[model samples]
Target: MRSRNSRLGTAAALAGLIAGTAMAGCSTTGMDASDTITIALAANPTGAFDPYRNREFGISEVAPFTHDSLLYKTPEGEFVSRLAATWKADNTSATFTLTPGITCADGSALTAKDVAAAINFASDAANASWAYGYYTPTAPLTAVGDDASRTVRVTVAQPYGYLLDTVGLLPILCAAGVKDPDSLANRSNGTGPYVVSAVSTGETIELKRRDDYAWGPDGTTVADAPATVVFRQIADETTAANLLLSGDVNIANVSGPNSDRVRAAGLDSADAYTAAAWLNFNQREGRATSDRRVREALVHALDFKEVIAVSTNTHGVAAEGLLVTEPAVCPTNAVAGVLPGQDLERAAKLLDEAGWVLGSDGKRVKDGVPLTLGLRYWTDRSELERPTAELLAARWKAIGVGIEPIGENVGGLVKTLYQTGNFDVYLLGWDLRLGSQFIPYLSGPLPPRGQNFMALDNPEYVKLSAEANATTPPQGCDLWGKAERAVVNDFDLVPISNRVTSLFYRGVTGQLTPVEPTSLRATQ
Candidate 1:
């Protein structure tokens, strides 16, 4: 399988984006008085800052400063104008009228043609843009720009539900960036409130506020925005927290045990939930997990409540569905009772009925082959994953099942799951904001051909998802809910837990709903 990072947001990225640690009694002593905000990134960004390509959570958090979307979704779930002054959309087509006077950092005007070109580049399947699946539907699409009227129109082949939300939010590239493309690999070019002033490779990315920029959500300007925004790469969470406490850094995310200290210290914080962990089985023909009975037996072997607690370091809630991020387009409870509760006897019975018998060594054997499943997990949260894996292994072992834990980094995990297809079960997190986003991962072609890494083929899920996609939101919500439920009920994937990532800030104030750099301003 040709590998591509899954479109869903990974847990490590979410945790790193806003993560920090805390030390009691520490005061903001060395606070900088300049009009600059220093934000700590959990790790250095891997790829380019191209909004159409890089979807890394860390990059997404900072990209807004350099690249402006046509429309912005407010914390209140309302769509507000940014680069686009007005917009309207139907199920498959949308039009956006650009806000006049917007200019790129290079002193060139941002025209309708530039915006349309960005949409076209990102929508083309041959370009392999990450935004292809997340922001736009995989189906063929076209964009036309009427420079005379300052309007850009997009039309999809299928009836996509999120035409406005997805297409409207696509980051527009300037004429220069689109023409060259290669120039945006390490640098940036767009019509936003800030410009990339300097890049120190993996160490730091510095952005300077644009003085003439007047376009922002609801007509907000950069009058109060910091003059310079610095994204400092700090791989260690505790170190990031210490920097926040000392006033060396203004913003950082707090997770794990350190989050409690930050809460106790009464530091200002904003919380957002993301997919922390989930279980997905490889259902290729010969895999043991391909059998529904085995999948159900494994799910029924352990208490999810305890698993959530242990896996999230006691800082998570039971997942309601795949859409855990804030402002989910369809916030329906699709996972309430879809999964079976912990029942050891039922698990054992199901395993036995699947033709797996317990042997002398207390291991399940089917046709003389031991039932040892390869359980893969990302090692970014080894502190929590190790214990969670042990807890799961202990429970499954009691049911005469053996588990071989395989730990890998994010890149390695993607390789094994999407490329090699060597694992049986894998645990990971997903940060998704729309119901339609799950369709590609749930029912599309498998691997190299598509992103359905688990090779799932659920007729009901496929049917419901297609119906849901044929209509617009609110109108399609019911179908989307039923579609997600089908995936859960069939054990295609299990929603393990969702963690609340808190962004702690000191000497700064802004919108926490998303922590937009344009919205942030120095308090000291």
Candidate 2:
């Protein structure tokens, strides 16, 4: 499933990299070695800690610390063993051999039966897991485990590409956590390097390192990891930066103006293209954006280059496609010439042909109704979202289009998009890693039924995506590229810009993975 806070969660993955210069000669020094690491979350977590159920950005931000998957995907895109020491897959089936001596946080031996149960639970549609559509194949599948052989086998009836990539990310729960799922609402029971020690609801989540964790990626253990890692909720970017500089926090994601401040403070930082911020028009019936002409016109109404500068504070690049994460499954540019460039004249002409006549008061009118559109955006996602909304509103207004910029927090925005469906347009970023993850958001039943929040019904995209999903990667990359082009050429969503999320770190050193900190060692 597309994380509810994909934009923020994915960006936070790169937020753990510590610079060597900033941490020089500080290895195991000033701060308590056991209490040295502190991370910042953009917002308070409101969902359960259940990896399969909670897709909140805050939940995802801390997932790597609390959960362990079957395998780990390195920043280089190589799949390494975590719980499963060896794994092999075909188009329709996959087998994983669990590592010996792997145990749960509760000290119970992690057997193949536990792994199979987690898979069966997540893959079952009856459980209504969002992971079913995004992480697992939509087709029927079965998982069986043999404890004696320490093997768990998964088989599908139809050809399903990305079988390994999908299952690799499934955070395997212990037998207890799987049996009493409700107990995982605020606690964790995984074999990861950390365990949830304390939670103050929306304020903070404290994790203590698990010294027994020895089956990490590449056999890394918690030997050098901080004894305690705290994720504190600090909403303001400037505040987060200040805390990092003051040594109140060891890691924080600083974007916009504050990023420069953190950099000047001698903090070591790394940037990742975490998400693609874009404009998604609600294409349900009766919406003005339902007309292809209107969608194209609106896309042509603004200079995206300028929008990118304003929205990202000059730290973003023009988006190439929907997949922004590095080492994308399909490394093809599907958006080069597919989307229309800025053309005010063309926009006006299209709007005119669509029956939105320019009015005397400088607004479009069609059939006695004013052409006003509600442009919704998340207020707290970035310091730039508001200005970006204002910029788009100003540009669209110049073309006789009335835009009402509506600001909401992440929760409010999700409710409006998925449940209320009250807005005409939405401006947000989707932090996605795979091409298949885009299908549920781009097509399928609308909110309360499925996650197709935009209500898009592109027949071409639907057809191409189906063909692409049936084939494995490398072989399916061509079909995936065509499917992405179909979405872009049709202007289903305007790819605005790709933000470079700069994560600032201080007084810490460790292996920096694309998604989170692994084998972290506190230097200060």
Tens-place lDDT per residue, model 1, 112-140, is: 88888888988776775656666777678
Query: What's the TM-score of every candidate structure?
Result: 0.89, 0.92
Which window of ten consecutive residues has the lowest lDDT sum in model 1? 1-10
* Pairs with backbone N, CA or C atoms under 3 Å apart (clashes), candidate 1: 18-253, 19-253, 20-253, 20-254
Count of backbone clashes, every candidate in sequence? 4, 0
What lDDT, from 0 to 1, does candidate 1 have?
A: 0.74
- Report the alpha-carbon TM-score of model 1 versus the true structure: 0.89
lDDT of 2 by residue, 1-524 (tens): 11122333213121111112233213323687656577776665565667666555323567778778888887678999888899999888999999999988777999998989888888876675666766777677888999999999999878887878887777787889888878887678888888877777656777778888889887777777788777776667887788888887777677877888889878997776644358888988899999989989988998888988988889778888778665678866777988878999999999999999998899999999999999998765777778899999999999999999998875677689777998888887766678887887888778666678889999999999889988987898999989989988888887778766676778887644343546677777
Where in model 2 is the C-alpha error above 4 Å?
1-29, 57-59, 513-515
